[model samples]
Target: MNIKLKTIFTLLLVAVLGTTFCFGQRSNIYIADKPFVQEYSIKYNFTNERVTLNSVVSDRNGYIQVLSSHGLLRPKAGQFLFPGELVNDVQYRPTSDKGITDADIYKNQIIYIDDKAVLSNAWAGNLYSRHDLPNAKLFSAGQDFTFLIADEMELNLLKDSETLWEGSLNNEIQDIKYDSENDHFFILSAGEIYSFSPKNNKLELVLQNDKLTCIEVAGKKVLAGTSDGFFEFDAKSKKHISQIEKNLPWPEITTIKSVDGETWFGSTQGAFKLEKNDKFSYYASKRWLPSDNVIDISKGPENSVLILTDAGLAKICRKEMTLFDKAMFFEKQVRERHIRNGFNATVSGMTEGDVTSGSMETSDNDGLWTSMYLAGEVFRYVVTKSEDALQNIRESLDAMERLYTINEIPGFPSRSFERRGYKYHDKKWRRTEDPEWDWKSTTSSDEAIGHIFAFSAIAELVDDAQLKSKAILLIDTLMATTIKNDHYLVDWNGEPTTWGRWNPEYVNARPIMVGDRKINSSNYIGMLQTAYHFTGKEKYKKTAFGLMEKHGYLENLMRPMSEIGRAPETADDWSRMLSESWNHSDDEMYYCGYWGLYRYAFNDELKAKYKEAIVDHWEAERPEKEGLWNIMTAIVGDNDYDLEEAIWYLQEYPLDLVNWTVKNSHRKDIELIPENFREQTIKEVLPPDELRISRHNANRFDLDGGSDGRSEYSAGDIWLLPYWIGRYLGVIGEPVQK
Candidate 1:
């Protein structure tokens, strides 16, 4: 349950200067920097062989670096500088028998920096790091592929793009399945909840409290869910019998859902419906909502139970309400049942030659045919005559056109932007780098631009005239190269930049513990509002109305409230309403500047100044109980499902959530949902989440503001700021009397 905090990017651990200049420069010049860790003691011999030496490691802040490599040396006093401590002339590639021969890894040594001290290149198993040096591949993949094994993306297991037995929750896990006789699965973390070994993931902490957040398994009974209420333990006397109480017009809780006893909980102060005399009642945003800020609800597929919130997926049904187009036809029967089992859902790479799995791979295999690029464009647009929905849109589009490979190149060219330190994801984005070294810095900016806006939203939702003219010639070849470089983009598509060169120092990123730059170009005018609804292009709606009027959005007019395509809304306010000046990491830049001024900023006193910057950012940071019920009391489906505002901000805003291990960006299409609104929508795929705080305590809070992780704001900042205060400014997809 990780959502809250909207800040971060403070030099993010700093280090990446050297703007440009080179030579023997001593591995590049006398280094007194870059050795956070490079140890290897095990013996007296040569940690294999391939020598080089230079030494120094000071850090009172003078910050310097040179270090070079080949591998194996230790002469700084005990200084064993072997191979005649090479200065003797460069030209060597020794030990080609695959190096390291156990003197306990031949005392494995390989660190670098030369012009004067701060060097060693001993050698053992993998420090191939040396593209002519500079943070020599930053800590040169040392300690055998970097290792920090902590930082709040913890409580885990890898591999999720497609199963190790249906695994899928990296942050929405709420288990408890005891299945028939004795099979187990009961999880929950951070404060504590474990029960594992469901066939060997192993763990057994039964239950510890601090207001547990989720856990389920109904039959043998074990349903937890809490902020203040819900429990049911019974896995063979690990006893807690049944606790239920705490429920009202607002007591908290978040999510529960049980089936037989009919329970359903969802409570950050709203949603409830118990029955069986466990009696709970209470559910509004007005007779079953699209917002009250709920996070996840499950119970779907027939009697329906999918809800999600903060304002997106909804499908209640009991009293009536099931449309986003039948939850995009229950996300096209769960992406045609995961493309009939051949599920790819790729995000990174691994298809090999001519590439595929959408190209680029050193082997992190990010395979996605997105159930066939989203049921082959929802079978050209619902009207499905079913042949299992045209056999899952012809095998998820023959696996997204052979996966990935139609012209690709880059072993380097800022190959993932100077390869940086590491965060280079491996959960899949088709891994290749960032096993988690940390991240130094460089650039590439918007290289793939979320697979070119999900391949231009699958060629503009099926009207694929040559894949929408090859996604408008690849969005004008990435606005003529990564949005025309404003030092890696911040302006060039008509002012207000920050979308193209989005740098969170990519590696294998866990990002978003508290990072902000607010999701690249905060809804980069929804890429000129999807190229002004595909080619209606008034220069893509006047360069997305000049990036929400020179990029500052809801500062005065151009969006905040509503007036649909504008009118005389407020004399165009401009900076007058200073409800504490404003910032939720720039509220996805005023929710994409009021959805690019309600789908094209026509002006209604600037969408009531973007609707009074959402009730003046809750009357300047929530003016009392409306203090947004202490900063948002409900509606949370993802940003890690906010465990009731993460245990009341780790007991009142403790902060800390910087876990960047990014490489390739793994997000194998979970459940997208949107085929003209799938029969009216109600999809639920939950089963991969596991980050219950502890990627080493996920940065140990204190992230008071410095994040840009999740790379600051991109779940499209939960739809350009709750589609203007949640669905076209309330009424859940508009209509209370319009």
Candidate 2:
């Protein structure tokens, strides 16, 4: 009876997410490849060569093998194979299953080879018999999608595992980072650098090639160290474009890391660096780094560089690199580039649904920028959690301290240098590296902002005067360099429209007494609150008052004018000019495109204005999806709708609820923004689907319009935030894992 109940509940879950209502009735789209099996204690069977797996393994060669859950095949030496007809290397059809490819072997059901195996890595489980790995801790677990894990049984046979990974000496990984932007990991293995997404149920082989010395991912490039020398590979095409063999003084390339638009590699002799143009330079020994023999490299914000050497972890930073300095970096890139492809098609087209022509950008989410922010948040969170992150905080503080003591600041007080983050490039946007803060320029301000956030987080967690003082120095420089006017901050550099609005000059330089009611806005309101806590700077408050009281900033909410405060260009245009406003003042919570911005909004006025905007927008668009004539299902989880109206909207934007719920563990009101919908009208009644998604597959032409942009973090920002918030506030997430 219990089993039957479990089965029934599972089917109900499927029904909740599977169906959509078009007019008044439900329309479920999924016609399963086969009916749901309900046999008791089913025996293992491999009759069909290909099977849809609940979980699987991924491998390097791009080909995957499988272990059938219902097959009689047993495991051997960590190598599990399909029980039935093993197809030839060339074109071959599966003996039984339809559309089964060599790559799909591991993608199919996990054939448990051994029971009670515990060779789990932090990212994936056991790695051998079952594909039970965990998602990489460092990478984001994107909402509304499911990715399987690879087990050891498959790993042992997939690639050449003879050599121990460099970071693992008793087989323990040093660092495991999954780049959700690029969709791969930076793994340290037995003296070699391995870059790959987990192959949960895949089997392919790569014979040994010892020439490889280092491997790293820089934007679209994959850098590798080889026998002859070093080379950069195309991340998409997987083609080796440039190579310099035996170029390094040292023979072995120990590690290669991507940081700030440059590729840094470590070898037995020392450390070396590479620019996007493939220019090679050395930074090893006491002169550039502590030791020539480098073991690992981790790049952090504020020109901070972490190098793991024979002498332990060594951190290097230019003393001047600060929050104030980073805006210049954004200014430089925005001045040089003009490429926008992600979601262009969707916005322009009136088709029921479709994708826009947007190229994948690198920094769409500003990982580096967010990293700086998150570092501060983490600093506070972990410190408050009882010294959990104290070691990290201490080490980070110590590193900065060294840079301060050394007086190694970027040369430019106003200018800065930074890597082109997640930005797609065209020749028109020919991004040229700024020479001023190129190599040793003193980066500041934003670095100060970062320090302030970090230090404040630390201060909140633990009273640390040294950290507080360091943050203070950063603000002092920012105030000195950034000229203030009319409750706004103008850029220190000369006039230029930029990206990310890191450029202060462009940010603060809104034409006053302007035509078209020039609405210059920013999220600096949050920063003001942040700044007031530490600096007690009344200017921060004054700036907030200027924007709210003086500019009539509330009028521009969703007006198609410079919104989001980061870009002036429409979805296609690079609006760095607008982005700068966020740095100068607050009120940016609205532009963030997530529920948390609204939910956790720090500034009360700004928060209220944003809520009005969301509600107003909801009211305005509520009718188009449908009038208040439908039943709200899992599909329509928004604030502006009653149960019936939201149901109509769900019918209008019917997504594959069953497939969606099965895939992702997250509640998807709109990516992470779903939390905001809890108190909304549609949420009061049982939604039609099992879960409601804020953002759905984005393209008209594509079969499934899941997010396509590599860098567009806003892709599901509102969706996920609402969902997470909902989970937090009893809206929705996954059911109890147990």
Candidate 3:
């Protein structure tokens, strides 16, 4: 065959194999269609300062009732009733009765006790049973109208408004719970746990501990809470079932309850639920509660959990959702509040974390963030062919195009742009030739690589001829200018920006251990390969090869990840600083550049090497469970790149994007480790909701951070990009039917 015909035939063969690989085995490759818990919270603050909440219960209708020192109070909903919706109008309205001290839900009936008598709200408000109880503190109801009431030092058993048996204890009573399966009531005090059998009229000590504070009985186990932690005992054997569990979010356990066969604990610091695999889903801070000091917990309306705190009540609701469902919800979130002049932006300066009180703000890395969002939309358009996705791509592409034209330099893209006087206070802001506009300077390599990644995706995947041409032109403009200026992005001041220099002199100066050495080589070569692939330009191809063979760029890019660490003591100051810790931003830059590096390799041999490098880096990053990085690694057709963890990341991320203050450094459940070069603080990473709101550039292992709800991050770059990209790669399936 002629050389021309041979080349065409090879291209056709590659196309056929690519199609087979992408769609043929898609059934086995996609994310499983399983439901995940999506949690959100609704909080109601105290109406008055005098009401002291003692206990909480919910009836069959899911109406929440709180027993306080003043009276029975019902928390009325406000105009807005959805989860994560904030309204100040929800108030605890008092009932006609007063001086109620204890309450319980007995067979869907709300029963109450006061200083004088026991009352049942089950019989048309006329079921008052008189009793000689004084200073009633707590009560447990049993079958056939049997009640076990306790005071500070005494207990009274009443049946049919008559005294059945009375007993005394050595210490102050704390709580009481009835075990229906065992036909007995378990009593908790400061020193001991006792079981009272009404049938035999006997009270016997079951367990003895001075620190016991609360008690709960579930089927065959009895759980007792204490100041240090909690202990479990077998109900049938009356012996210890487990040791004291000190590994908790907070150990000062104040209350414990079993709701829907799942255990929930309330501590002085917050509340947490015991999930499968011995993990606790921590609910603390203002994001999930009104205050961290939890008083009680109960099942609430619509399969929610109600947490009573010193300041107010919090209702945590969970909805069943798949990854695709979450993606669509985040898509709406971005379009509503995060779009600023077609650039994905954050809402900053929010007053006390109120979403309605914030305004969109420009950022230094707007170009990078917008490029990520644009690439996500292009992937969405490719996967689903949604018209809305195409429109989003068009709008954001316009914003990206303006980044080049807004500045005076021919191929330099601005960091961001704003009105002339609005951003003039910053030293990086410069007046454009246009009178009404100003453009940000000092653009970093992060923005440069992000632009190339988005442009390459558009040039290869988008079907629009005009859009594809524009994307290729931008790539040529950027790469040509870099080559013309000795591989440096020249600013209007005729100096190279600090981070945009990838010339051999600067890149090769860093020690091999420093991440910047590897990342810069990888990014620069990827850009050259992408340019040559799209534009068919020999200059880009030649420049890329010359750097690889002569300057050892290929060796630098192919260095194993395990060998990259802190610089030697004899290294330069800049190299030492760059290697002092793992630079998470470098991770972001590397993955963003991976799209071009792996997809547009110069030849099959280079493509195989790129896949090895990408997979090696992913192996080191497995501890983080970062969805974006894991999903991006799937582009190399590896089936074992922690796909389950990727899905877990998407599912576990909180629906509320508000930057509420979150702290996990004080948690007792997590296993802390010695400080290392990777900066991993614990043996395992906390879920996304338990950590602060952050973008892909932030370290996931950072224990505590936030602005106390002063800003809301955009979901466009944080969530939607990874999700849509996963969908486009056939690693995540469509939304499953309910």
Which one wins on TM-score?
3
Candidate 1 lDDT (Cα, 0 to 1): 0.32
List the RMSD of every prediction in angstroms. Answer: 29.2, 26.7, 4.4
Runs with alpha carbons beyond 4 Å of true place in candidate 3: 1-28, 47-50, 76-94
Across 1-738, the per-residue lDDT of candidate 1 in tens digits comes to: 122121111111011111111111121111121112111111111122343222212112211111224332221211111111112212233431222211111122333322211233343424332122111111111122221111122322212111122232233233333333454445565456765443565556777777787665666677777776667778655688977544333445666656435666666544555556543444433123334556555443334344444432334433222223323333443342222223332112222100112221221111211321332333224233335533444454443333322112111111121132334543222222444322111212232333334434334333324433444444444443433432133221233232234322321021221112223433444454544443343665565465455553212232322221211233223212212122233332333223333333345554444344444333322211111122221221112122223222222211111111211111121233453201211132111011111111021211112211211111111111122122211112321120
Tens digit per residue, CA lDDT, model 3, 144-189 = 7788998897899887678778899988888888988888899987
Each prediction's number of clashing residue pairs: 162, 143, 0
Error of 1 at 461 (Å): 9.9
lDDT of each: 0.32, 0.33, 0.84
- Please report, as a residue range, the 10-residue window in candidate 1 with the lowest summed lDDT: 6-15
lDDT of 2 at 204: 17
Output the lDDT of residue 265, model 3.
93
lDDT of 2 by residue, 464-513 (tens): 44444444444333333332332222322332222323233443344332
Q: If both were scored by TM-score, which would come out higher, candidate 1 or candidate 2?
A: 2
